[model samples]
Target: MTTLQPDILIAGAGIAGATVAAGLRGRGYSVVHLEASTQPLDTARGDHLGPRVVETLANWDILDAFFAAGAEKRLGAKWLTPEGVVIMHSSIDDLPLPYPFYVVLNHDLIATTALDLAVTAADYDYTLFRPVAARDISTGADAHGGVTEVSITTPEGEAVTIKPRMTIACDGRSSKIRAACDFQIAHTYDYEKPFVVLFGPRGELQDPRNEINSYMSLNGGVSRIPRIGGQWKIGLAIDKQDIGRWKSTTSDERKALLAERAPALGEMETEVAGFYPVIRRESDYWTKGTTVLLGDACHTIHPARGQGMNFGIRCAARLFDFLPDPTEMSDAALVAQRLADYEAAVKPLTDAQLSENHERGLHMDCTGPERMQAEIPTLRAVAADPDANFRYRMTMAGYPDRLDPK
Candidate 1:
């Protein structure tokens, strides 16, 4: 086995991992990024990047490239009844934010674009190993003892040992690195509503404002988001028992099912993408020793609010804030300390958002008046209260840190 040592090791090349890899490389950090999948990077989740993510893109010098790659901008979002009656509408146009619009693009496009831009950095000195899987992870002492070493296998059937100052696990919900490090989940909430994703040509619905229109009722909910290239991405909420029926359904049958469950989206012809479980959970700890967890590896939230990718991107940015120029630091202990500091500064925000998301998810996927009864009053009250509305807009727009209530 060949042994390699790098300043940092990032396991996974999804949006979260790519964001961290690109951002760190732009800052002159030496990193080794590993991706277990030999297939091209394509995911069904996280197409909507909240507004604040643009700041990080700009900082990494990829803002123009990001938009140039067919990303669409959305000014705001609306809550409506399935019959097209608006219940609540929130706009970011008046917010005090660096960017006033969220972006919509394919999840794969974002991940690949970020990594592609990272290599173009003048001081880029990182290695990306694709089809490389971390087979073994050994943590010394305790969770705080950090990782002593990781054994990875490459596509070429060669074995390599990696020792790093720090290791970040961004490998999604079932992270091998997180499991190997023995991090336990302290809080978890499995949302009763499950959603199936769909994408198709923009129907007769005229969206001059380019906003996310979410239709909710006793039958269910349909969140219609505009995609680049004049298409629409739909998230159709369904009951838990329907998950099995959805899986066994044919494309045409799926259409009929949509019509029955979410009438607002059923009329539009769209292809079924896949099912995404709505589960909100967080690990008991984010960092141990020189090891850290990020994105879905540490915390996951409901997609109803569209904050999963946004929060992950912000976590990467916040981690960079707590870290020094890698060249200025080489001590493993110091790296561990920075990891602890990063978790300290970011976890509280994540916990609060996850809790709120859990509550909101409960009101979705209803088949009766309970959903309306639970949601209408809350939505109307928020809209009636300017301060509450402003805060809501800020949080939903990906500016939780800047929520200054008047």
Candidate 2:
């Protein structure tokens, strides 16, 4: 093991960074994980790990532990009109995939759990530095004109330098390494803001057979997803400009708004879980010299489909498939090519996915009687149509475009 410097430095211990770290280290690569936050993680965002992601977890052999830690398995989801009519229901129960269901777990827990396992695995060479951030960064040159040295400061104000083979920026959209390095982004800014998340007990709808239910109407759109231990996680897609008005509302007032928006799902406990912004931010390139961007650092899609982290996991898996042998790390060109390959494989597919999701979010934000009349019927027809509905379920299951030719 190169104790003085690891082969790879993974910035940000969220889903993407942690997944890649655990993944590469399991294959016996040396990795150093850096995370900025010391406080307990709020693992509430994007709990739905679609069938593809669940299969990835199973391949990593971490699914069992995830379930043990209270992750729920869901076969599909249902889209409903506010009056409780099912507009569309997507299922994966019959798929031949390893896990024909979405795995619902706290994102923070999955990352931490995977990290914990990687750290303790008997043969994996993985080190973790939490509550530490990249205070300063610079690329150090090597004989081959590659960036070979990277530096950071620990939480105790100690300076440390790493001659890593590669540095991965998995930090979220606001990535420190990304900012310090200034990776150019090609953004598709869809609608933003007024997105709210509510978490509490199983409000009113609680059933083992029930898939995720997204109720929509002229008022707004709210999705209620079931969780393990009889809890619930819900998301709201609303007008971007009304975010301030939302923030000023009381819990009771907020609950009332959800009632008006989602409707018919029954009442939640009026406890605020969390709020997040939904934005579409995609980077122009995935690699620069020896550094690579993964997850939100590379691309961020709207949360309407609950596919943000799943897409990141997909990036991790594909990148894992394309990773170079540790001995080949000295070839900067080769590293950049590999990152490019991963990006090439993932970006087109994810770009399409994000665009479709953005359109879906737009459809979900309808707030007028006329728009509702136009939307509900259109949704019903599409849901009834074989090809489109198949695509819908396939997308929800994380395997978009899996329809058999008719």
Candidate 3:
């Protein structure tokens, strides 16, 4: 078994991990990223960086690459009532930013691009190893609190130790590193409404508009988001136990459901279908000594608002801002302080977003009498005020303030 020592050790090479690696390297921090998979996972979910996220990417000077990797630029978002009435609409052009409203790209492509940038950046030094799993973590007392050592097992079953000044966990919702450090996470999993997602050719659907279309009723809610290559992504919230019923529902049954619940989608060619359980996890404390948690590792939110990855990207951007000066402290101390500041700065914002999204989900998925009651006020208000529609649109796109740092 071979051992390697680096200034910093990162777990997971997803968007959060890749973004931090690239940013830290640009800031002159040595980083090594480890991943358990040699290739990208074949998951339908990907990061959808909103306008604010785009601004941060622009600052890193890599937004163009994201666009180049088949990201569809969104002009605005629209909210529709069950009767196919447009309640509100918001455009990206109104936002004061360097780029367009937002870019929706495949998650794998974005992560791969970020990783590629980090590996090739001239300003910093870094390394990437895949098929490696972190099995153990140890911390020792130091003048500045302590140092962390991580043990990883490669695909070949060889164990290697990475002794770094500090370690950051970006390893997604089920994080081994967070568990190893004994970090406590306050969380809630809403099994009431699970989701089934489908993806396919855009031409297979009716009224396949480029804009994001949200259809709401008392029984549930469904969203159809357009993507590059004439593709469209569909998500519907249903009872967790009923997920099996959806699977049993023939393609014709699904099409019929779409036609009934979402008439705008007259027809669609589904290429794939997936199921996801809704979960929300947050840690009151995101750091412990030389170890810190980031991205999904630190917090996991419901995917209703499409803010899961967006939140993670924002966390990484904040970590970049709080990075310590290498000259003023040892590598270990620098990493510790940076991790502390990262947690302090990110926790509050994440908590607020979680609350907001949870509420939004409930409002959008109202059914029966509740749906009628909710739509009456929204529809009446939109008709009464023209600006009301615009404001609603902006709110969905994460308006007013961009995701960029304040």
User: lDDT, candidate 2, residue 317?
Assistant: 82
What does candidate 1's lDDT look like per residue over 195-289, in tens digits? 88877665444665578887766666667787776777778777788888877877677677666645766667777678877786688999988
> Best lDDT goes to which candidate?
1
Best-to-worst TM-score order = 1, 2, 3
Q: What pairs collide in candidate 3?
A: 46-107, 52-403, 204-268, 205-267, 218-366, 218-367, 218-368
Q: How many residue pairs clash in each candidate?
A: 3, 0, 7
Residue 336 error for model 3, in Å? Answer: 2.8
Q: Which regions in candidate 3 have their CA more than 4 angstroms from the true location? A: 143-147, 155-159, 202-209, 328-331, 362-372, 379-406
Across 1-406, the per-residue lDDT of candidate 3 in tens digits comes to 7777666788988778877776675666667788877778445775467876787888887788787877667777666776678765656666555665678777788888888888888867687878676667676665133336777776667777888766778898888887877677776555457777888765543432357777765545677877666677888777667777788876677787777677666476564467877777776578876777788888887777788778877777777677667554355666677778877766776677778887766654444557656665775687467566555545555553433323
**C-alpha local distance difference test of each model:** 0.78, 0.73, 0.71
Deviation from native of the Cα of residue 114 in model 3, angstroms? 1.4
